[model samples]
Target: MALGWWGRQPVAVLATAVVVSAAPILSPAAGDRLIGDTLPVEAADALDVITPVPSSLGADPDRVALGRMLFSDTRLSRRGDRACISCHDIRSNGASAVARNLTTDGTPVPRNTPTAFNAALSFRLGWAGDIPTLHDQAELALTRPEFLGGSWPRILDTVHGDPVLAALFQAAYGHAADREAVIDAINSFERSLLTPDSRFDRWLRGDVHAITQAERAGYALFRGIGCAACHQGANVGGNLFEKVGIFVTIPNRSAEVLRVPSLRNVAVTAPYFDDGGVATLPEAVRLMARAQLGRELTASQTASIVAFLGTLTGSFEGRPLTASRASGTAQPGDTP
Candidate 1:
């Protein structure tokens, strides 16, 4: 049982939400032998940094239910044609398969659309660490001219105006559509978007058969080459804000320091990096190895690491998430 931001602590102190891992599975022959029998005591201690995903969210069912519909409802958008789903697609790892997210105001969003899945578990929100919580992010995104281009009053009118939405919001919040209530419902629903039970998560939970030997080797390589220094938690890399070009120079430098993204579902969310410039995972991995770790990996090492990353792709609403575009390094044919 992995614990995310919801299970660890209440959202009142969500900024400091740190995860506590579940008890490790005590198996030898089933999952990756990275622990219990195979890994030494010191090596196992290193794994303490990584945790498993929680099974469920700590939110009101009614509010979460309402939030789910609101998340995809274009009616909530300013133009009534570009809702949250226009940028954050649930079917595609909680993000649109594009570099820059589009807005209804005919202007491109300034930053890449980070995955909303398991986002509550992050220490800080947004690429620049500007937003504090999911609720704040929601409120800001709703009104940004380059985003939904919506105002709370206008959104409240839309929600209260529509008979269906009004009923849902009233049922969930015991009140008509309002800013606080709407944001709360959306926040609650976003908390429910955790993608747990990945193969790596299963392995962490003590199932040796969950991941393959190659993936285990890749995990070893991921840490062995120091990739896990920043990417070392339940969400993997969202905990820290580190400089992008620490080791080597990358093409077209943007910001010096950036909020690290979770590597939990990195395989499927391609055209990687803050700017979404890197198109393929292998290319991104190779670039990261050079830029972040000062290590040059061979093709086999990159492939193995990518294989391990594929294990990070988890399911949503009981359906497993598959590779979106075929242009990435780890595709459907790649073993998990």
Candidate 2:
């Protein structure tokens, strides 16, 4: 069976029959081929690609300072209402739990806001892998219709108009405010958001006492039941793309394919998956096991894995209350 993030399975033969009858002939046939294979050797190779977390690209003192300022700057938005940190909140786990954050006009966005914590480690950015790097993603977040809904030229104009911001831009990049420097500073700040001191990291570094016995058992079960087929490595996931349902049928939304998310700090970033359909962590665990593993897990097993996941949470390193140019009392979405 194809493994999922958690080890639950579709009901039983009855569930299998229902899936087979409803599924297109090709899907079940493909699933059977996948199941017959003995844990694709590529799975191990996938794990090998994961490397220890790296320092942020623009983590120098000046760049980080500029990026932090830009991150919370509300003027980057069209309505002067949303900042990058609005959705990618520094205090939270880099995301809000809501299905989507409201736009300046209160139009609900189409997808959940993904956490920015450890985003620099992602092989690809965004749920659909639409953007390529932190720089590109930051640009999209500023200009995407569903996001800040502004243009690059307007962004440059706003940054240059702010005397404090322009000075900071000069300090960070040795030039006055412009789009390139803005993205560089923002990306630099984002790069600094890495969190690697979790209990799992300690365990990897030979501190056996870092994690609990139950967590260790859950980690074992995670591999034993095939959850690691897609969720392996330092990030524990986000390295590869996988169909949502490998052994069973999954409800599809507009975009059918999704990149696996990193398990780091997953405990606080709730309402899981690309759609944010599943509300609780346990339900997500159960659903994943059923949909991917083609095997059922005991409640105890699910609880243990959840316990291990809790250990993934770590501290947010960015400063929350930094000065910005011409900022009054800032609301949730306001740009700097």
132 Cα displacement, candidate 2 (Å): 1.7
**Per-residue accuracy of model 2 over 1-336 as CA lDDT, tens digit each:** 011212232123223233322222223233332221232222322222223444344478788888888788777788877788777766656776576677667787777877877777666777876665677888888888778878888889888888888888887778887778887788777877877667766666668798876676665555546676666455667656667777777666432667777877777777788777887888888888988777666788789778877877666553321111122123654443
Supply candidate 2's per-residue lDDT for 150: 82
User: Given candidate 1, what's the lDDT at residue 33?
Assistant: 46
**TM-score for each candidate, following the candidate numbering:** 0.83, 0.78
Candidate 1: residue 136 lDDT (0-100)? 80
Q: Assess candidate 2 and give its TM-score to the true structure.
A: 0.78
Q: Pick by lDDT: which candidate is best?
A: 1
Give the root-mean-square deviation of each candidate in angstroms.
Answer: 7.4, 10.2
State the lDDT of candidate 1 residue by residue for 64-141, as single tens digits.
Answer: 888877777665667766667566666666765778865565655677778778888887788886676677888877
